[model samples]
Target chain A: MDLQTLTYIVVGFTFALYIGIAFWARAGTTGEFYAAGRGVHPVANGMATAADWMSAASFISMAGLIAFNGYGASVFLMGWTGGYVLLALLLAPYLRKFGKFTVPEFIGDRYYSRTARIVAVICLILASVTYVIGQMKGIGVAFSRFLETDYDTGLFIGMGIVFIYAVMGGMKGITYTQIAQYCVLIFAYTVPAVFVSLNITGNPIPQMGIGSTMADGSGTFMLDKLDQVVTDLGFKEYTTQVMGSKLNMFVYTLSLMIGTAGLPHVIIRFFTVPKVKDARSSAGWALVFIAILYTTAPAVGSMARLNLMNTIQTGEVGTVEGNIEIANVPQWMLNWEKTGLLQWEDKNGDGRIQYYNDKNAEFVAKAEAWGWKGNEMTKVDRDIMVLANPEIAKLPNWVIALVVAGGLAAALSTAAGLLLAIASSISHDLLKGVFMPDISEKNELMAGRIAMAGAIGLAGYFGLHPPDFAAGTVAIAFGLAASSIFPVLMMGIFYKKMNRAGAIWGMISGIGVTMLYVFQHKGIMFVPGTSFLGDMGPNWFLGISPNAFGAVGALVNFAVATVVSKVTAPPPDHIQHLVEDIRVPKGAGAASDH
Target chain B: MNKTAEQYWKANIRLVSILLVIWFACSFLFGIILVEPLNTIKIGGVGLGFWFAQNGSIYTFLVLIYVYTKRMNALDVEFDVHED
Candidate 1:
């Protein structure tokens, strides 16, 4: 009946469903472990892929980011979704035709060099491991909020859930569980959005609702009202704010697009489908599923911002009656305040909460005249926007519980996908491909489980003591993948003359330059206080943020590889034939390597 | 490569090029480069450029991928390369 009990029950039921799916789908062979026996229908794989692609960042944090960043956050929406187009058009079907288990394996065979495979494995591990840390933290946050546990305990529990299903089911288990996860997460996400939309505007569709007039017969468009409200409080107009420099937004979007297309976890999902045609169409379906959440996000974001402002600034700005009395603050604020995510201080001993731009010197005189101290809501963390939205809107307890379950599903599905990519690279690419070429299938499967368990442990540890960059490190992961992996994969497929030497050198240079730029700004491995060149705009090259430097790194990679390949001998005839073979859909082998 | 397979590959390349150009125009051009000019024109309570960046480009991307898959499938059939 209560919120806590309801959350535990809903979350418990979802976890039980996942464990059941895992037990039922336990993988029996390497083919099943890595590619789900290549029997997954296109639509099912699409659902799985959507679950795999939308991580905790998308479910929990993206709308929150949009709430504050306004128009600037469009880079994330466009960059992430556009990459699926690249995946479907340029990468997916061809890779499916290649019939490989791991992305590095495709590189290893296509380049006819083990070194290239090893390099690829390294890139995949780096990007995936970094990405998984965010997912682990996301899971920890969801558990901490819902189950009322400490972050460390929540992380440990999350790691255990992944270990049970991922170690036992592998890709086979993960796929079906992800399909379930997609349903849970999408349902949870859209329900509250629909409620919030209807309450704000009469329109039921959040997308159209955001563009329609307010329900109170205000006659002003929602965006028009939102822009007027925020700017009235000295903040930037909601619709007019651009993210950073134009070049940076462009490069950042480009990096995320190619990076999304390049992620090993996402690319491998297409390999589970039965045919090349399935891979192509499955990508379209995946985008359709992802778009459901993506479209709802902006609506949730802008509307949540509108709702949040209306809660605090209950009337016109600069007036004494505008701010809400601290004693009369909504119960949701107190609930989030207990988590230390939302905080306020009465500097001028004013009993009212002022949510406005304190940095606006022009408003300082007005604030002084009104006896206002400053912006009292100092710690309204962006992560709380989505999690606190339902409570803020006075939604029923069951809907709030469903949001908790959905957040966990989004976080866990993505973590499992990344863990699988990491573990398989260790067992199949590193161990069997390199160390023990004659490893039995049974022994390889064992190795895969051990590697997966080990990865979860490492990810959990990082989640507990997340680095300063954890909030934005996902962009870094995308940057690394875009710079290091995507270019080489694209080259291997499109350029027949690209040789082993070129591919290896290209990966090294791409990752190397990207890392150097990032480390110089963010610090090596993102260790705080270790950055030699402080992270400041004036210090950046061409006013490009470290996040946008991936495009430059990718360009350098393409250039270096092309120049190197011209000097070196072309790939052997057999490798050329392999490339030609992948290009055509005929005679595609079953996903099973045998 | 056989003549039919070769032509199919070329057709695929041409199609990708055209689709990708549309992709570039929607997101990079309208959303970023020419956003200021596009913002002069409002669409449905939002700036056209902002709509492109936030909503319109994604719709176009979905349509592009779906169209590519359909056309490529048809081309595969024409070249007698469709999988059984």
Candidate 2:
């Protein structure tokens, strides 16, 4: 079958499956909408959470980033996984026991102040909006490339798909749909990885592929072999540091951890399990499911890097003497070439693409000796690795079909989760909890749908006009979430002495400082005519990048809250009892209103 | 029940300490700072430290969490702090 027919069957069927799940499991009440009626089994919720957590960024970009960065990118795997430990052990149980509808609801009730709740809402919206913009952009990019539609058409179509499932079915619908998504996405992710792993090493499991000696017959370890190849051509070693950077890597890991914990979509998934124990069990399950994908990503990255370099070097695998004629480049290259992710420009009359390091002065001397004029292959987008992996490995059409289905699974799962989070924050936390305390459940449900539609439209707008940023704009979502919501939720749960005033001020401090730090570094949020920081050495205070500033913001929250709580009054005795109740796992109301 | 609550809390705290220490050791300590020392050892042609840095630690994290939850559930029953 042609690309058009395969794409229609894959993408169309997945979208249909989501709508089918939504109809099968339409949320009847606010509880069902917000927390999946608190009935999801741990394993099911775990699968759903994994789908929710691994967004377009994880599906499309993470492995590609790691492929280029080598060992340093291990931070993403470790930090992201480590976050579940903190969530399960420290946060999830209590939050589930409290059984509030939203994170802000917990803050408002626990701190005994509406002001704190509103501050939390502000933080939640900021983090979530920044995050959702990235997802929308991911959907647009994925759809445009595969469907051969323009970016705007893709964004609108993606918006329609998310709005249908999220508004109609809510969290309850998204949960079952996400479980389906997890299967499709993981299967899509692993098939190509399995193929590439087996091709490069005799190993089928990606874990083994990472360790197995390179197929190079050169007796060097894979990373060591890769290091030699790229370095010989004036590129940085595949396993060693480039730009002499570890400080940024270390801090970036911390930020990713807190950001994972802080993400509203992820946090809301934990609220779906039946009880506090299930919350703990489900978090572990989420991590376990997530690890399957996270662990495989590095293997995919390393193997794909090797494959890419080898392709560029030898042209057709065996022939190292001649160049890869542009017209005759393999089908996968040509396929991705159509997407504008892979391109070639013959700089000299060399009629072939030279993909070696243009930045390497050493490669220039060697290349000139080989009758090459300038570097002809100017750019290769990272998104191509994951998007074009099956094709690049020359896998079956079904496998390529699976990749499209998986990318859609990732994009749609996250989009639904974010949409639900936004809708609930508006309908449950703001409209009902704050403004109309006596609003009927039916009205709130209607409001949830309306709000979700509005949110999807806004997210679609962001997708169409994506802000230029590395790893795309979704990267900043991590920074914003880390600095904002994580601190507030943890403080509310762990610190019983915390008061409303302190919680509000501390969140402001965390969100304010971190946002300023990010705005200073990324001129995306820069004011016109304002000069940003020039040097990493001098500008970032105490050597923390804007990406990692969230951890410091968290520390400030703890310190500020502690000082304020000590000097001021303690929380109401009932609120103290609420904390104790969360721990004992008894007398936790089916849902806490106060 | 008051006695049970105190015992359950104590057990929870104890379990958290053990798990937290292991978590820190595998990730913050072994995976990062002491990675150099452990890199001298290789497992399956992968450096021991690098394996831990990438995959080993994640596997360990899952095991530790499952064990923690299982033990805590048992402790909850032992202390009679479980739900009715």
Candidate 3:
């Protein structure tokens, strides 16, 4: 069968499976709606969390980022995974023991202040909304490319599927559906990787394949060969190019780590498990599942870069026949060109495609002597490295279809999770907890569903008309979470004396400074032409990118909160006792409504 | 708080501190700060530092969590705080 038909069938089957799971897992009460009745097994919850945490960025864009940036992109790999340690050790067990539904609920009760809860709700909404917009865009792009639908139509279809499952099943529905999604996405991701690995290095495991010698009897290590190829074309060595300065890489990694732990969508998953111990172990299992893909990514990235260079430069550089003729360009290039993500022009009036670092001044004179006008490959979106890898490697059509479904699954699962976080904070935290404490359980559940549907509508609209900062949303979302939410939650659990004033001011100042810094560099709210300081390295504070400033923001939060609490009144007696109780694992009753 | 409860909390804090130190050393120290020096030592086709940045640190994180889980569970039982 043709590729599009196979994609339709496979993607349709996965959608059918998700709807089936949603039907079977329909939640009846507010408890089930919010926390899945706290009955999910540790392993199952871990799988669900993995699916929820690994968004389209992880599945679609991370390898591509690594492929281009090389060693500098290690910040992403380490930063994202390192947060799991913090979640498991410092946060998960204590929060699970608190026995509440939403993250804001814990903050409100712990600090004994309605204002603190509202601040937390604001932080959660800001972070999650920014994160969800990226997923929605990923969904639209995947559908437009694979199903041949327009971007708007693809977004609406995606929004509709999420509305059905999320509104009907709540956390219960999302959890089970995400388990299925994890299976689909992981399988889809690894199958192509394994095939490409064996093809290139005669090894089935991609993790080992990247280190082994090439299979073409070159007798050179894969990384060694890739390093030689790119450097030959005046590009930086593939294995050791730093992204920015070392300080920026360090802070950027730290920001992403804390941000991963702080994201409300990820934190709330632990609440679905039955016990404190389960929460700790579940985080481990989640990382294990996540690691399967994370470790394989670097291999896929290095190998794909090697393959791309080899295909374009069929022979040694500086030779007459080095570049490939336009007519002989691979089918994958032609296929991706239709999507507008990959483009080429016959610059210098030559009918051959020359892909190289034209900007390298040292190589300019040499290239002029070779009759090259400029690089012919004008644009290559980093996302294509993973999305088009299977095609580039000439894998079977079915495998390509699986990749499409996998990308959709990754996007949809995380979007659903983020929407649920936003909805729950509105319904369970804002309306039920603060505004209408006397609201009926049935009414609250209805409110939650309405909020979820509304969120999906808003997300769909943004996806159809993404903002200028859509490319920078990951950094914004992570920065907000790391700066505002993570610090307050840690203090609430670990620092028993942290008063309401401390917590409230900590959140405001932390998020406030982070926003100001990011806006000054990236433009106010990421609008073009509004930035006071240009987004350049020398203009940055301490040479840190706005994305990396979250860790610094977090430090300011810790320092401010500590000083503020010292000057203000300490928490009351019962509040201190509540902190003590959460520290222990005993008497952890079922997650309860008020 | 009771004496045993305080001790259990203290033990938990100590264990977490040790694990966190290891986590920092693997990712930030070997992967970033000391990467240049460690690159002199090769592991297969790649430098030891690059391996840590992309691969080794993630593996260590996995092991650290499992170790913490097992030890913390044992502490819970010893402190009579395990959920029935």
lDDT of 2 by residue, A444-536 (tens): 999888988887877677666655322446656777777777877777766667777777777888777777777776554533334376425
By lDDT rank, best first, the candidates go 3, 1, 2
- Scored against the true structure, residue A181 in model 1 reaches a CA lDDT of 97
Residue-level lDDT of model 1, residues A1-594, one tens digit each, is 999999989999999999899889988988889989999999999999999999888998889888888888899899989999999999999999999899999999888888999999999998898788878877877777786656677778888877877788889999999999999999999999999999988889998888888889988889999998888887887887877788889999999999998899999998999899999999999999999999899999999999999999998777878889999999888877766668998777778888888899887677767787788988887877888889888899999999999999999899889989998999999999988999999999999889888888887877776543333667788988998899999999889999999999999999889989988998777677888999889999988888777778888889999999999998999988888888989888786562
DockQ score, prediction 1: 0.80
Candidate 2 DockQ, CA atoms: 0.65
The TM-scores, one per candidate, come to 0.97, 0.94, 0.97
Docking class for model 1 is medium
Worst 10 residues of 2 chain A by lDDT: A522-531
Q: Could you tell me how far off, in angstroms, the CA of residue A459 lies in candidate 1 after the best superposition? A: 2.2
* Chain A TM-scores of all predicted models: 0.97, 0.93, 0.96
Ordered list by DockQ, greatest first:
3, 1, 2
User: Which window of ten consecutive residues has the lowest lDDT sum in model 3 chain A?
Assistant: A464-473
Clashing pairs in 3: none
Give the per-residue lDDT of model 3 (tens digit) for A1-594: 998899889999998998899889988888888888899999999999999998888888788888888898899899889999999999999999998999999999999999999999999998888788778777776776785655677677778877777788788988999999999999999999999999999989998897799999989998999898998888898778987789899999999999998999999999999999999999999999999999999988888888888889999798868889999999888877876668999887777888889999888778988988888889887766777889888899999999999998998899888988998999999998899998898998888889888888877776665543232466678888999999999999899999999999999999888989988987875666788998888999889988778898888889899999999999999999999999999999987676
DockQ of 3: 0.88
Q: Top model by DockQ, which number?
A: 3
* DockQ of the candidate models in sequence: 0.80, 0.65, 0.88
